[model samples]
Target chain A: MTEQELVQRAREGDELAFAQLVTDNEKRIYNLCRRLTGNPDDGAELAQEAFLNAWRGLGKFHGESSFATWLYRLASNACIDFLRREKRRRSLSMTVSLDDEEEGRQAELPDQGAGPEERLERAEDRRAIARALEQVSPEHRQVLVMRELSGLSYAEISQVLGLEEGTVKSRIARARAALRKRLLAEGNFFGGASSTR
Target chain B: MCDCEKALDWISLDLDGALTPQERRELEDHLAVCPGCAALARELAALHRVLPELEEEVPEGFQQAVMERVRAEKVQALPAGRGRAVPWRRWLSLAAVCAVVLAGAGSLGRFWDRSGGTEPAAGETLPVQAAQAGAAAQAGAAPQEEAAPQKEAAGEGQGPELRLYTAMADPSGAREAADSGEVLPEASPLPTVGAAMNQAAAQNEDLTEAQRAALTANCAAWLQTSGLDPAEAGLLTVEAVTQTDLEAAVCPGEDQRARLDLDDYRVTLGSSDVLLCDSATLEVLGYLPTV
Candidate 1:
């Protein structure tokens, strides 16, 4: 049966059909969570929560958009809410201080060469970028993940997030800038405006 | 250096391959003169290239875990008592009435047909209508003589404030209906906009100011999820509504209307436009352009 048919059956309380639907979209949804939260454990938990929400909210899932699109929205919301709560907790407790010069110096890159050192530094850069992503505001992180990680086009990101294309465009630009600033602060990248975290 | 800001914006867009040829050319021209922008563009481009590597594999047994939860929820959600049984019978009868009214009353029928014609489900759709049925049933059993006593009780502060505030367009008529003690019928045939508006407005004298505040907050939260600024929602007029009012306000298509549940409120965003949102989850049902 088609996904719409599965969705219809699931709407009428068909668990098997719903499971099938879940199997189909699990990877992307999990990845969406992982990218959004920057944690594998949180991604697994949030992805599950998103599907559970989808099950409870199946009645609400009118086929206005594709089921996958709906799942993305749900997954993104779960991750965003989790991040917001985490942010609040961090703010209250003052965790993850950015001023530690030791931590900041951890990813400092050497000038260009394609040696083993460069490859190792590139891996650190990737890890640093991922870490920097988590530090960006949830709103920016969300659009960034949708654009870069989830591979959603601007139009699709607009659709998934229910934003205007123009808004999505500008937000992605700002999100990139935010991530870049974070990377610069971490000393992962060589050149950018000299601003401290 | 004046062009640096614009160049940076273009560079971000350029990473996504979003820059137009002319824009790209302009960026290149600017980059040739500006070393800072050139370096920023190269780094941003490289960052964008590696972003996809961040995509993680779905952990083993992920689908199994999700399915396990889904099965658990289904078992939990299936009504244990006669709760599910009662709504099904009531919904069938109501659906029949809705079918007849929709077929015979051309405009109103079309309105509801577009409004998804009231799905006979266990969740979201049934609960509100079931509650409406319960309310109507109580009102039916109560004598018209009790209306006077109730009004007196309300006057003496024994009841909630009897002030009628309907989100309907015809405010005066709503006041009149409330005075006459007209509880909107569950799935009643509404022929005119006035009557339809009446169908939309079911006065809850018992709904507290706190409850209304909660409903407004729920809508504002849902509005945020719907990609609307909560401040924008604050500017719109809000009213607590049952499923009937939700249907009336969100008379777009079946898909949109099916999202509303019991106690969803309508936020009148414009004279003709409104938003329907579930109170509990604060999920936006849809935006409606009600005529």
Candidate 2:
């Protein structure tokens, strides 16, 4: 059946149809979450939450936008909310240390070393990119994830976010600039090559 | 160099495949003379290429795990229907505790009168009481004897007092029970509670659009004081309240006394805080933070 047919069934509380929808969108949504959060675990949880929210709110989906676009909006909102809560939680908890996050991130990097020096450098570069993405504002991260990671066209992003196409265009531009600024600040721009004017 | 601002926009557009050929040519023309713009374009293009490569494999069994949670949520949502099927036992225990508070509602009424509290209008407390009683009856507890005196107290110009009683008891139980397809008393407290809320919402229509605007502004301002962006407050729900008891439940350490002239309003600021503001003034009264 077409996705719209599945969506219609899911709206009527058909779990099988909803599961089919979930199966279809799971990988893309998960990658979107991962890019937004810069953490695989958070990405996984947020992706699950996005699908669950979609299931619960299925009744409200009136086919105004494609199911995929609606799903993207939900996933983006979930990641943004999670990011905000994490910020608040971090502010509230005095015992949380920056070192803990660093240690956790280091553990996440692969230990396999086919070419010890090059592989380690590549891993460091990947970490720099992830860290730079994380440092950007959540709104910036959101548009960037949709555009770059999810391969959503500018028009699709506008529909997903309910922003004007002009707004999405400017936001994507600013997001890229913000990300570039972060990489430059950390001296990780151009894959650690020497900075050029 | 001065036109680099437009050039940067075009460069970003070019990276996204959004620029038309004309715009792309204009961007290239600008880039040829502007080293700064050229470098920025190259870096952003390179970043764009790297970003798509950052896509990670979805974890194993991810879809299955999500399906399991969805099924669990479906089970939990069943029979009682949406937003209503709470663990009724917890509400029953809360009802048991409120039953004691109801015993002293007479004195509480007097305290509000003596303290010059804004007692809600007559017949207002009946619905909330009906709600509590409905919850009690739903739990198979005989609350008739306990409900009788509170009705009399509510009759005696103790509108805010009894609603406060209901708030302390269970403001939500009545509405949820009313919405659920359960056998309830014809004058089921939950229905009365639901009707009263609906009536209140209906009355909201009677407010001139100006009044609604003022209420929204007051809510947004109060949310600002409670550490929320006023811009996002438009998305949060705002409601009028005579008492902050339920609001207090959501916002602990909220000073009820700071309420303006015995009345306050509430704004749900995400899942963390319910901000209470004075009904007449923009003064922020109290907030309940998530424990």
Candidate 3:
């Protein structure tokens, strides 16, 4: 069945139809979450919560946009909320150690290159980039992730973020500039170009 | 001015294919002559390449976990009486109850008209009547003759029993009764339901659990009357119960106040139909067909 047909059936309370919808978009949603949260476990949980919310609020899906776009909006909101709450908790408690968090994140990066030396260098480059990304503000990071990672069109990002198209374009441009500047400052981009690439 | 700043501006847009063809040509020509701009563009391209490769895979059974949660929420939202068999009998009982309450309300309207009582303002009638009935019942006085028909209707027990009482004695009558320690009669289920929903909606809170259940039940009753099968048509799940402003065009005049005012719960079912219900009386004020 077409996606619209599946959505129609799902609306009619067909569990199978809804499951099919989940199956179709799970990877993209999961990847989006993984990138946003920078943690696989947290990404999985956020992705699941987003789907559950989508199921509950499915009636509000007016089909003015594609199902994937609608789902992206929900997943994005869930990630943003999670990040906000985490930020608040960290600020309030002051118990979370940044070094420990970075160590945990380092262990999560995949190690696959032509050889051990190359792999180690690649991992270092990955860590540097990730750390730089973490330093960027959430608003800029979000637009950058949507544009570069999720590969959404500026128009699609505008709809998902509820921003004007011009706003989306400018934000994305700013995000790119910010990210590049941060990587450069950290000596991860232009400084060690030969080894990093 | 040097074309360098403009080239930098166009770099990200060029990668995104967002630059105009003319602009793209200008940037390309600038980059060819200016090795600095060309190298900057290359670095931006490399950053784009690395971002996507960083996304990691989620753990196994993620889909299973999400589906499990969805099933659990669905089961919880289903009415207690829902069974393997369709709920036609329950629908019938609901229909019968609605008929009784509506009939009783019509009769009460006629009674008021005959007694030379004007129709009270939108906010006035129910609270006043409730207070008066509470006082009269507490005093051990029999309800006036005008309430007899409604009392008989309540005795049938097929639907929500509306307590008949005098219209508000005055604008502040209900408040006065409350302050004086006069117990207000238990409001008939309909208006109390309406009042509670209106209060919650005004605060923009999600419906309380009881209110959510009532809304689901109300939607079921409406689907039955519309000749749609709640179970088969997927109208069973109450996705949302929210209060929205009624457009004057959709609901006109006093009818708008009756139907669209704070008293209406906009019940969203599954992914389709939206039913506007009078929170006070469980009346389906407006129905938007499933999209």
Candidate 4:
């Protein structure tokens, strides 16, 4: 069935249709959350929460935007809220040490099809990228992840973020520049070669 | 004419394919001379290439776990035919709170009499025989033989005397008389026991002269043992006599009555303590501090 028809069925209390919808979009939502949170466990949990929220709020969907866009908006807002709350929690307590988190991520990295050496290299590279993404401001990181990882168009991001298209475009460009600067400063980009500049 | 800054901006836009043909050409012309801007473009392109590689897959069983949670939540949200079933723990907590409030109000309700009235006359009493007669009549029984025999068997030495004191201080008589248009004689200065008995008799016609005199003596005895110096505390008037469950303040949990015997009288002692006393013997049972 078409996504809209599936959404209609899901709205009418059809769990099978909703399950189908979840099956179709869970990968993108999970990846978006993963990139935004920079923690696989938190990403998986937040993705589930986002889908659950979408399920509960399906009755309010007016079809003004595509189902994917609406779902992305839900996931983005959930991640932003989680990040803000996590920031507050970190300020209040030092329970989650940075080294502990890094170790946790390294241990949790999935074994893709890559060999052991390649997997270790890929995990290290991922850790560096995630660490750099964490350095970027949450607002800029959000725009960058939605564009780069989720591959959302500027217009789609504007719709999801409730910003003007021009604002979205400038924010995406600034986000990329900020991320590149941070990555370069950390010597994680271009195989640690000194910048030509 | 585009400077390095504009050239970098165009290059960033070109990465997104957002640059127009003219803007792309303008950036290319500037990049041809600016190796720094050209290197920045290459680094930014490489950064973009690496970012998407970091996207992680959802953990296994995540979908099933979410669906399970969703199903459980949906089941809980569904309304039962009877109504929403309150959790047992919540119901128990609510019941406990209600019991506490009721126990507190029952304890405090005796002392906080909002209806203010004049003090009962001193030295007035109600006859024991008359009280028994009234009690018998109310119980739908023939007036029993003079209560003297029963009083003796019940270990009440001065049953008539205690009855007289209780009836004289009983505010219910005065309230009843007030409602029934019986104006009690004005307080007499240095009134003798006989005069007080007459006043009690005149106020409540239901009680005999002996009952009135006994009630007066009972009131006098209560005043003596009330632990309040009359000169300092002023005249201690009886407000209302009500039956109440023994509260911890009066009767500790170990001493609390297991059943409703109704033998205790909660005597409101004129802005003083609520004195719990035996209704038959007129002995002070316990005292609850008012202030």
**Which candidate has the highest DockQ of all?**
2
lDDT of 2 by residue, B1-291 (tens): 226768667888888777788777878888888788888888888788667655666788998999777654532311122222222322222222222233333334432333222233323222233334433333222111223322212222222333344443342323221222322122223333223333323331121223323444555666666566555433343334434344343432335453333234444544445665544333356665556
Interface root mean square deviation per prediction: 10.1, 8.6, 11.5, 17.1
What lDDT would each prediction earn against the true structure? 0.57, 0.58, 0.57, 0.56
Q: Give the TM-score of candidate 2.
A: 0.52
With a 3 Å backbone cut-off (N, CA, C), the pairs that clash in candidate 3 are B190-B280, B194-B279, B194-B280
- Span of ten consecutive residues with least summed lDDT in model 4 chain B: B75-84
Docking class of 4: incorrect
Could you list the CA RMSD of all candidates, in the order they appear?
21.1, 19.0, 18.9, 23.5
lDDT tens readout by residue for model 3, B1-291: 329766656888888888888888888888789777777788788788667655545567988998777764542212222222112222222222332333333544543443323333332222222222232332211112222322212122221222222223222223221222222233334445555555433332223334434544566776787676575322322212333335421332367455455323454454556666564445567765443
Clashing pairs in 2: B130-B189, B131-B189, B251-B288, B252-B288
The true-versus-predicted C-alpha distance at residue B219 of model 1, in Å, is: 54
Give the worst 10-residue stretch by lDDT in candidate 4 chain A.
A92-101
Candidate 1 residue lDDT tens string, B95-151: 222222222223232223222223223322222233233223322221122222232
In model 4, the runs with Cα more than 4 Å from the true position are: A92-123, A191-197, B77-291
* Chain A TM-scores, candidates in order: 0.79, 0.79, 0.80, 0.81
What digit string (tens of lDDT, one per residue) describes model 2 on residues A1-197? 99999998776556798889998898789988876776777888999999988887776777999999999899988887887787787854212123334334332434355478866665556556677887888899889888987889888999989999999989998999898888888874575343343
Model 1 segments beyond 4 Å from truth? A91-118, A191-197, B77-291
Ranking by DockQ: 2, 1, 4, 3
lDDT of 4 by residue, B22-76 (tens): 8788888887888778778887787676677666556789889777655533422
